[model samples]
Target: MVMNKALLAAVALATTMIIMMARPSVQESVYITNHLTKRVLIVHCRSTDTDLGAHAVAVGASFHWNFRENIFGGTFFWCKLAVEDKRIYFLAYDEYVETFGTWFVCDDGVYGTPASRPAFLKAAWTRP
Candidate 1:
């Protein structure tokens, strides 16, 4: 009886570890292409809590890219999101701030970027 109980406890512990390892991980895929060098760099990020745009703007206020530490300015960028209780939508940036366009996921499974250009630092600050 003692040996049987010990074996059952060991089996349960093994099962739990297996379940944890098999869990899927959520990650962000980032890349940069340099036409001059004809090089493309890629990065994968995993965070339990997803950061939204308003959060990003606040973080951006004190943002500085630490390339020496392998952190990019873009990593500090958080999406300005328009979300409902059940769903979320991504907006794009232009030379100035314009609330137009929608974003979708690409075949690669990462969030798609807006077709418009990057929003200016100046314009983003003034907008409500």
Candidate 2:
């Protein structure tokens, strides 16, 4: 009876460990879209002092990044967008330790100003 109880306890512990290991870790994703009429948008994305490179998105196009495998420990990211001969910069910062999902939109011809900020969009509006 004692041996059976010991085996049961060991099985329970192993099962708990397996469950914990199988659980997925927290991750983050960002989506950027260009909603301009006749202008091309260039985007640069970076996090935690790492440069994730740049992209040129045409009107009505978009760019997306998933940080599931490469988790960023910081709570913020920096980005810049170029419109024609002008450039616009912005930063996405959150007080939360981990940002699950967020998105930005470059609408019309409003960006490329010194005081410009990317238009924050709801998760539902993330898709192009």
CA lDDT for candidate 2:
0.58
**TM-scores of all candidate predictions against the true structure:** 0.23, 0.54
Residues 1-128 of candidate 2 have per-residue lDDT tens digits of: 25788899999999887876675565656667677667777889777656879898877877777654332223566777676666655564342443324444545232222224444333221211
Winning candidate number (lDDT):
2
| lDDT values for all models | 0.29, 0.58
**Clashes (candidate 1):** 2
Which residue pairs come into collision in candidate 2?
Answer: none
> Which candidate ranks first by TM-score, i.e. highest?
2
Worst 10 residues of 1 by lDDT: 64-73
